[model samples]
Target: MSIRFAIVGCGRISERHAQHISNVGELVAVCDIVREKAEGLAEKYGAKAYTDLDEMLRYEKEVEVVAICSPNGLHAAQTIAALQAEKHVICEKPMAINPYDCGEMIKAAERANRRLFVVKQNRFNPPVAAVKELIDAGKLGQIYSVHLSCYWNRHNAYYANSWKGTKALDGGTLYTQFSHFIDLLYWMFGDVKEVTAYTANYHHQGIIEFEDTGVVNLRFYNGTLGSVHYTVNSYQKNMEGSLTIFGEKGTVKIGGQYLNELEYQQIEGIEIKDLPPGNPPNQYGNYVGSMSNHDHVYANLVQVLTNNGIIATNGFEGLKTVEIIDKIYTAAKPL
Candidate 1:
């Protein structure tokens, strides 16, 4: 039986979820504050359309999974509500704007005995997966450090009269744009033990309430140090989103527009073989971002829901991502 799915937001990211969910799941309904957006997606999939989440969940009770593509800040509340409604949830990245909110969502999931999955699709990138395999195999011994860079452009036009530019909804660049990179750090390394950071709004000052540029220094529980330098201040387009790791025996670099390629590698006895091309990065009207692997995420979701498989990005993992971001933001003084 196909898992019945309903989307809570029909925004830009929902395009990815709607396009691929039909393969392994049935899109039974779509809900959005904007009725037109919900109707648009609903008509395409022949699903019911709703203007409110509670209305959809109340009437379209067959929905087995709630795929939340809502704004960053709304993820926790929406996810908890869906869980309380007895539906499994697959939330878009950042999980929530804060660690406490994420904790609440997780608690709700536990009480409802439902799964809470976070979408970290980049983990499905071939290079990323291969690198993870090496790390797990202990080929990269004593993983010393990691360096991450994310430089992209988000002009004033991108935020003009939009919820994205606000602190309450979008949070900041780290939440909206670089959360995936932050997640990758947690996924690869263990819990972060320490963090120091600084942030700035050099370009998008009045346009956005939070920083458009930031740098973070991290120390993982294993005593491995790491650093992240990210910005949405690139002039014309995205500059890079790359992650390089140095280990006792190997060094690897996963660099590309969206962590798509295995740019560099030097392992003692292991060879990085021919890797298949990865899914393309998401392209908005004028913006581009992390790899578009929602299909892979859906596949995993289907496996977990249908075959009782484990989630690659579970609630705890999602909470950790938010917690790390919270730590960084807390460490950074006013920009």
Candidate 2:
């Protein structure tokens, strides 16, 4: 049985979700405030389009899944509405601006007895998956600290054209881009006990209220300390995202785009030695770095729903990510 999907907010990322739904499941409907954008996606996928989500839900009874791709701030409300309508939801990252909204959304899903998945698709990367497998197998025993870094160049014009630059809409670099890495941090490590962060708008001078550069210090529940360093300023446009985990038996370093580089060293007796090489793809050619590979995650989600398995990034996971972001932002605020 194919899962019918209705996509809300036909923005830039909605195109990727539409493509995936058309390829993997039934693309039942598309909705957006802008009629043209919604209709455009509907036409491409042979699905109906609506300017209003309520109308779409009422008419498209086959839409069992709702994909919320709206602005960061609108995610919680839209997700709760979708769940109340008895539809499973797949919300975009930065689940909500704050933990309260996230909790409300989760409560709605629980009340409706529906599944709510969050788009932390970065974890689906091949290299990242491999590292996770190793960690699960206890190759890197008794994990210690982690260092995560994301440095990408986003010009002022990029934020100027969309609702991305404002705190009221897109949140910030922490919400917009680094949210994935932040979730990955929790996914691999667990809830953070405490966070201290500093954020500033040193670059990308504009009329925006969010910062382009920020640093966060994290103390995990297991007594593992970590640091996240992020910035949206670079001269030649490059992406550097890496996670290094230290353990008692061995230490693992996964670097490069999407954590595509992996190196493991075992502390055997006298000194440490590097393990055999893991698959590391070239940095330049992966066109659809993280966002474009929605098909893989979507397929897994469909199977989970069909087989009565648990959704990978469910509403609780979404809320946890939001809570971490809320704490980080709260700490980063002016003192």
Per-residue alpha-carbon lDDT of candidate 2 for residues 13-93, written as tens digits (9 for 90 to 100): 888788778777889899999999988999999988899988888888778999999999889888888999999999988
Candidate No. with top TM-score: 1
Q: What's the lDDT for all of these models?
A: 0.91, 0.78
* Local lDDT at 289 for model 2: 34
At residue 180, candidate 1 shows an lDDT of 91
| lDDT of model 1, residue 23 | 82
- Compute the lDDT for candidate 1: 0.91
Best of the candidates, lDDT: 1
Task: Tell me the spans in candidate 2 whose CA falls farther than 4 Å from its real position.
Answer: 263-291, 333-335
Give the C-alpha lDDT of model 2.
0.78
Q: What is the C-alpha lDDT profile of model 1 across 192-285, one tens digit per residue?
A: 9999998888988778998989989999999999999999988899888899999999999999878888889999998999888888889998
- Tell me the deviation in Å of residue 52 in model 1: 1.4
Worst lDDT run of 10 residues, candidate 1, spans 153-162
